[model samples]
Target: MIPDPDEQVLVDVRAPLREMIFPFLETIVITGVLWIVIGWFDAADAGRYGVGPLRLPPEWRNGFVYLWVMLVLWRFVLPLLRKRRRRMVVTDRRIIFRADGFRARPRTLAMSAVTWAEKERGLLAVYLQDSDLPVYYSGLPKIRKIARMINDPLI
Candidate 1:
């Protein structure tokens, strides 16, 4: 929906450092596990599969692993870039999830549609809070202020 000419933005919420870092850490862990699995397969007896091990030299294996790790790192990079493009904007009339990218479609929830708003505290809670809709502003600084804006009747 188009904003009214008189509409004003009250808060621009962003993902906190913890929210941003966790995904990178998770990606690293997953990629590490994948690397271990690959190593196991490489070391497995060729007789088990009726096929010989890869004929590439040891240096080639190292180079391939390095390239694989770099590719896996891209998984982490994309999320960070996407998060950078994303923003939660609280305005006088609604809450908006804006992603400044060609493939992203902005989402907005009218304030009146929010049944409740609260500042939930906890490690995972901070990162996982959401309304019924897909739009969320968890792990954002000034969360209390944002909640107040959403819950206030006089806004």
Candidate 2:
């Protein structure tokens, strides 16, 4: 929905640190493993190309490590950075999420489109909170108030 210029913003929610924690941890672990694998490959000679143990040149191994790191950065770190920029603004008529960066797209949900709203909690709730419609917020202060603002028609 095209928001009215006069529409008043009721809530502005930023993606919280808790929302980034899992992806950050995942990136760290995967990158660490890739580094270890690259190191191992550099240190050991492995059978390859139907021949006995073969050792790749140090440059080739280094190149592979560099490529892997780049891949990880693109696949994980870049998205994490973009996610950090995510913000959800709830206006009188609609909810707008501005996700700016790689593959970025703004998402707008008309308040009229929202059929239901509820506060969620539990182990996985923090991660799940951002994806549901109307408002994208997780581990945020006054989340209950935000939910109420979204759900109450009189608001």
Candidate 3:
């Protein structure tokens, strides 16, 4: 978590969210590479091999090409085009989330809206995210204060 300009806390939701990124990229990259390589092999073995019949005709290259294009585009290009605009700010009264990349809304969640929060130090939970949900902090240096604040009686 990083401190905001007015000293309000910023708890990045990215850490847990980050767990999904690499695996997703790896899947896409591996699948894309494998498919493209298979397509290339099939194209090369057009007459002599038995696999050519299993592949789409060369005329369908456009479709496979388009699929790979979209995969690569979504995997790499889209994010660059979509501005990275996610901010999770925790203030005295509320938690504000602003995301402008895929979605175009700046949402704000009031502290009172936080129905529940708990900490889990179990091994599974620790490696999965090092935190629990409905979590309010994300490595935001002052975890104790935030936990105490959220669990505070005043609300």
The number of the candidate with the highest lDDT is 2
**Where is model 3 poorest over a 10-residue stretch in terms of lDDT?**
122-131
Better of 2 and 3 by lDDT: 2
* Per-residue C-alpha lDDT of model 3 across residues 1-39, encoded as one tens digit per residue: 244566455344422344347646765776778587656
- Model 2: per-residue Cα lDDT over 71-155, one tens digit each: 7787777766876776767788887766655565668777766755666762112122335533334445466766777777476
Off by over 4 Å in 1: 1-5, 23-62, 65-69, 98-104, 112-116, 121-139, 153-155
| Candidate 1 local Cα displacement, residue 56, angstroms | 7.7
Model 3: runs farther than 4 Å from truth? 1-4, 18-46, 50-58, 72-87, 98-101, 109-149, 152-155
**Using TM-score as the measure, which candidate wins?**
2
C-alpha root-mean-square deviation, each candidate: 8.5, 7.9, 8.5
Give the Cα lDDT of each candidate. 0.62, 0.65, 0.51
TM-scores across all candidates? 0.51, 0.52, 0.43
Cα error of candidate 1 at position 22, Å: 4.0
Model 2 misplaced stretches (Cα beyond 4 Å)? 1-5, 37-55, 81-86, 97-116, 120-142, 151-155
What is the TM-score (0 to 1) of candidate 1?
Answer: 0.51
